[model samples]
Target chain A: MDRLIEAIAATQNPSVVGLDPTEALVPAQVVASFADEIADEVEDAADRPAAQLAVAYFEYNRAIIDAIADIVPAVKPQIAMYEALGPAGVDAYTMTCEYAQSHGLYVIGDIKRGDIGSTAAAYAGHLGGVAFGAGESGPYDPWHEDAVTVNPYLGTDGITPFVEAATAADKDIFALVRTSNPSSSEIQELELAGGCRVYEHVADLVERWGQGTVGQHRYSRVGAVVGATHPEEGRALRARMPHTFFLVPGYGAQGGTARDVAGMFDDAGSGAIVNSSRGIIGAWRKTGAYSETMSAESALDLVADAARNAAIAMRDDLRAVMP
Target chain B: MDRLIEAIAATQNPSVVGLDPTEALVPAQVVASFADEIADEVEDAADRPAAQLAVAYFEYNRAIIDAIADIVPAVKPQIAMYEALGPAGVDAYTMTCEYAQSHGLYVIGDIKRGDIGSTAAAYAGHLGGVAFGAGESGPYDPWHEDAVTVNPYLGTDGITPFVEAATAADKDIFALVRTSNPSSSEIQELELAGGCRVYEHVADLVERWGQGTVGQHRYSRVGAVVGATHPEEGRALRARMPHTFFLVPGYGAQGGTARDVAGMFDDAGSGAIVNSSRGIIGAWRKTGAYSETMSAESALDLVADAARNAAIAMRDDLRAVMP
Candidate 1:
């Protein structure tokens, strides 16, 4: 959290680009460019298309990362988008995270993974890394992610392993508190007999989960994901969980404006980072600069430029609403 | 649900083997056996260990699947275990699922994935498969799963896509209701203001989510995961979510006995499929027949034999408790 805070301060931007790629989000020509090479490399004809698309996704993400590296402090690569393509897509996800990190940007893997104690420990390997060959030589990090989003439905034991892994690796974990989607209210807004809503209880647990691991910035290794759409709740949560940072999503394409997320920040303007996925990555689609006849290189160039512009606009949008 | 129910009836075993492999669970000699081949295949020395382990996990799972194919109706490969090793492990997970399905066993991927509407649709691709090149000739099924486990914290929208995918693909999804872990009580057992517990509300949701998708077995595509650890509560839920099939985890290694899970079954013994992970897959280690000096092939033979015997024992144990 300290590292992310400082990176935000250095960039003077509190936004993370969501590197969530889809077939529609990525340029079609770029996917086409790899068909021949993939068809040659991949044995099965059924697999070649996904393999090609996976390669195209990496290229698309790489272009965006390079475009916004200096402006954005972090990038959130949603794993579901990659996992949609199976193993090949998963490779692109790790490659995207590694590429983002190599460019001095923090990578927040939006996996939303949760299970019981022992299983959570395995998932925590995203932070704890892996040791193969004998124990003496190495614990190679396959997923170069700084923080990952976790689901807290299984409670404390499910989260403890991630907290431990984050603490050990000087990384962080953000538990999903209140998501931005329409049906999020179904469970998160349920009022408990204790009077607090379920998400509020989760907010308190998230604060406690980060207790002993507060960094120099006064935020802990555990963070909370408070959707930008819930301004009042996000504002209240900002006060309720003082030690926890917030990863605010649902801005831009999801229809959350700067004013909606403004209250999620602290008085010092440092407690939260807003994420805009399709908004930034898919900016080229809205720019009207894309042409179907364009070469793969030219389309990527357009994607990169459009993303950089969108990221800068978002930065200014947040700055205008900052305390 | 019909496929799974029929498979269970055919084998007379309402049990799914959990193919969750860890370094300790896998025979060391088996992993060591892949060292030379992986060293030649993988360029980086740091990656050799996980790559080797990933290959070993596939082989280990193949043996278990082969040995238990005749006795067990399904296999639930917990994705987190494969995820611990990164992309290579993801490949193994898909491979394991593919192999198990090829062997005439229903493959239940214990992914527990959940997200917002669009994102959840992407995760649903685990059941729906992916269309790469032109969407014309191939919606290639990369993940050969008959069903997948999902988390229910995000409510209806997060679940609807999986339900839709399952309905379209003739597959199924089991949402987490009352998890097996001790800490699951924190949120799940919270008494809501509505007189029922939070999990009960979720149980109702699970039942309703499957309304229009009922199968020939009198169950629906959307199922519930009620832990074997909670007998009385699970018994209550068995009555609660009648149309929702149950994927009951925590059977053996988690202190859940056949007697404990007996109440989770329907009157006809058709509603639930229990899972055993380390209890069966790691049974080879507990067998006095295992030795550090045994060859990798011999260790795998022992693993196959132990897994088959364990599967038979579990079947008999559960049968003894059935109505």
Candidate 2:
């Protein structure tokens, strides 16, 4: 929604929480409470256990959505975690996407899928809407998502399908420009013939691809994912692709402080969404907020509070600099 | 399995068929035959549609395996097509791998997955079996396959996890050195420092990765996927990665003929497997042998015959060139 841009501008906050929901990381009460309901229906389908697991995942995402709906402007779901569960996992992903959309929260699917030619089109089709040939209805319509992350290793052809589909769906795409991982330097840092690093070339290409999809907010639907860990590079990338939104990861648990991400924001606190996944979900566990006897719900409340406080701090930091 | 390799060497054939069972391409009889069984079972659980679909996929793969077991030494299954269906899709994939193994065929999973660090380990953990975590029987295990395909964009960190797991399982890996897609050159052909192209660097890395994993057949378990279209490059990469096996694609429907891929074979035909997916599975549709007058078994027989004939021709050509 265009209001997403306006929401960022209005609150001066560019923080987006990631709803990863790893089974091992979830609170014990949340697991204990949902286990019975899941067990009753899943007992018959023991062979396909992922279906039952998906139900719990969806519930967990819904709880997170409910808790942070007022604090954050969007939620980014990591597709790999859901995909590892199988189709039932996809079902949960789709449902969570719909739930997030209904709550006026923008959904960004962190699916780094890449392919070439018609296969790329198929992936884009599946992401955008229900594809005709790849079994029943497509999982999670692209229109429902405000944006999706894509891998750029296959180059323009790999990204074109997503560009075309996203343009048609009135959504956005965030290409992997610089990832937060320590090993990202391996290929991304390789010098090309022209002397620019691979990631820089990708950044330039992203800017070009975004040119055709400019929205009413003066930003294009194409965005770049520049890790906040590389603050200087992030600023350079932001300067290079001024019209493109930046989905900056590596915040919080990834060792990026809020102050480190300040350069990604525009003068009005626009064009960026800083993401924090583990730092938010596992905050209570790390802070010892829950006692051995405390309920999971109480611990979750503290976890949600920690996330809210973190977002507020980030928002305040950006405002102090940009205001 | 080593003896099997010796047999293939003696025969001078490196042609392997890929079983990519897309639903749209299935024969009408097979679809109609399985329709009632699927419908009846789908009544109880709507979420288990993939399970029913997987049954059809498993049957189709079984039929294809039965048809080509005598013609080829190995089979590659594109995991994406199966995964597009969901967990039942995964079920179909695992079942097909087991079936191919039973038929004395090496199974290569064409899942071009790559990630960084622990995430890469998670992927390898799923593909290559993991031992029990502490006291648990391990979170999930597929018992590992004979081999799996990987992407090298994330560099050595991405490959290290795979190497570790595959080494532990005594399995193999085929890294994406160069793909067959027309636009692959966009990133893959970029010139790096020291006058070497990106693909050459990747081939060099593959060579290094294979250093510790050489099998008794004079070829390493680590392999590189060199497109058959690039004959000169294929020969050069083969020379560069002396011990690494070359998994050549772009044969048949991709337009590189049997002659174009001959350079990939070692002196003894010890290190390459050319793949043909649509050329085999969709042969009946292409040759107009699946007309209304033709029986399902007869049409299937024709499809298998074409595949066997193609393989034989390829085999004869390779044998003719050997010293």
Candidate 3:
């Protein structure tokens, strides 16, 4: 994994694609490709709606993974999308994580889970590997994602469990310091005493939390999710916590260009993984690059090309400023 | 459901038992009773650790539900306990909800889910129901639950989607105005401008959001979750939002007694559901009623008696004070 980071650095690209498969946003060809197969399965298993959705989700994720694995250092799968489908959704999530891992891409489970005390511990256990009862068989092995996203609204008690579990599992956590959504300012930008903003306080906590999990790559195993849309804030947070990795969302479809995200990285592109979700997986459908006659495989090829191109473009933009 | 409220008023008891099945708290006898069966299942299905744990969880919930269903007006299943087991956990959760419903008890799905905008709508869809292709299946059938808990951090946008969904489905939502956890005061009690606390602001929002869903029982479908530990605050909130239902937690094991929770109810014993999870479910085990030779059925009987006694005692306590 350390070697993979160095490899990514060598390419001078810190772009990580997000696989947020919204049912409505899937390419027409992709939907058409699976329509008949899904119909057959649905007919056969009328009692299992969640299972049918899970199968579709897995196929969609596999397509995106195959498309973007070569260009992206990691693939962030939004757990909410999978969870929305229910247990089968979780099954799809696990399968997608496994698929991404097999393709040599880091899997960041975008689960913005927050709770107090022991409940948080349970969530961490679910994300990282839970010890099997000595000898257990089955494909539902505990997931060991490279990293996970967490919310810190409940303060220290909420985060401690995740930190403990991630440490034991040799994984990482990206705490929400500032989010990309417009409404995020309502809470994150609250003015505190002595002229410090709430997010600044959060940034300091991120630094403190990362102290124990410092990695050899000049970043900590504990990371902060600082949105690319807030470039000035992102730069300040980057400077505030020099040793912490940054998971920067709000790129592409969220109105953040590569140039806006450049300040989030270290001098050597060592500290950030910029995420673009809707921009990548739903790119073909958005851009209309594939016609109706195109095969789903061909459409996926174009989608992958768009994602790879986006990553390359981001890399070039960053290098133009940094170099 | 309205008639149920009327029955509670007639019975003069506002107590609702919460079925939070924490594994560690299960009695030794009950644990031993299921051990062999669970062990065999674990041996057969080693791959699905979640499924194995979920089987135990479902059995435990069934035991608890069967024990207390006759006495309690409702059973609040903490979604986190079920979620900890993964998809199988969700299956267990659905089964538990159905079981509770079948016993003529309301099932409050204690899932503190909150998101913004379209994502919020997606959560509502997932929780309520989604529009699948005609005659085709969708995730979580529309009529699965009577009510669900929601977090209110994102303000109006976060809650409106839930309100719309609940209105359409003829369901209800208990938004987190104040939580029972000790750490809840950290953020929830923050002093805002204009002489109103953050929670008051939340209460006001709850009042506004719930305006449309007022049932014949004179309570709105949207409710506030006010901790029984904060009696004065709960009373104030109740006064401010007269038509809103109040779901009071932090009773019993969390340290707030029946007297402390009494203020959350209206004069007629309406608009409140006081929850005692561990106090009800784990009562017999803690009270040493489960001896060495006590069978699972006997232990369950003891549990039922304890819960029924507690509810009766609570009713007496409330009745003694009411004019």
How high a TM-score does candidate 3 get? 0.86
lDDT of 3 by residue, B67-138 (tens): 666666777887666666655667788788888888877778877676545566766754555555224333
lDDT of 1 by residue, A157-225 (tens): 999999998887889999999999999999999999989999999988999999999999999999999
Q: Mind giving the per-residue lDDT tens digits that candidate 3 earns over A156-178?
A: 77778888877776678888888
**Chain B alone: TM-score in each candidate?**
0.98, 0.89, 0.88
Query: How many Å off is the CA of A97 in candidate 3?
Result: 2.0
Alpha-carbon lDDT of model 2? 0.71
Best by lDDT: 1
Q: Give me the runs in candidate 3 sitting further than 4 Å from their true place.
A: A1-12, A28-50, A129-141, A193-195, A218-221, A242-244, A266-268, A287-306, A314-323, B1-12, B27-49, B133-143, B192-197, B291-323
User: Candidate 1 clashing pairs?
Assistant: none
Model 2 chain B is weakest, by summed lDDT over 10 consecutive residues, at B130-139
Interface RMSD of 3: 3.4
Q: Model 1 Cα displacement at B155 (Å)?
A: 1.2
**lDDT score, candidate 2, position A313:** 67
Give the higher-DockQ candidate: 1 or 3: 1
Q: List iRMS for all predictions.
A: 1.7, 4.5, 3.4
lDDT of each: 0.92, 0.71, 0.71
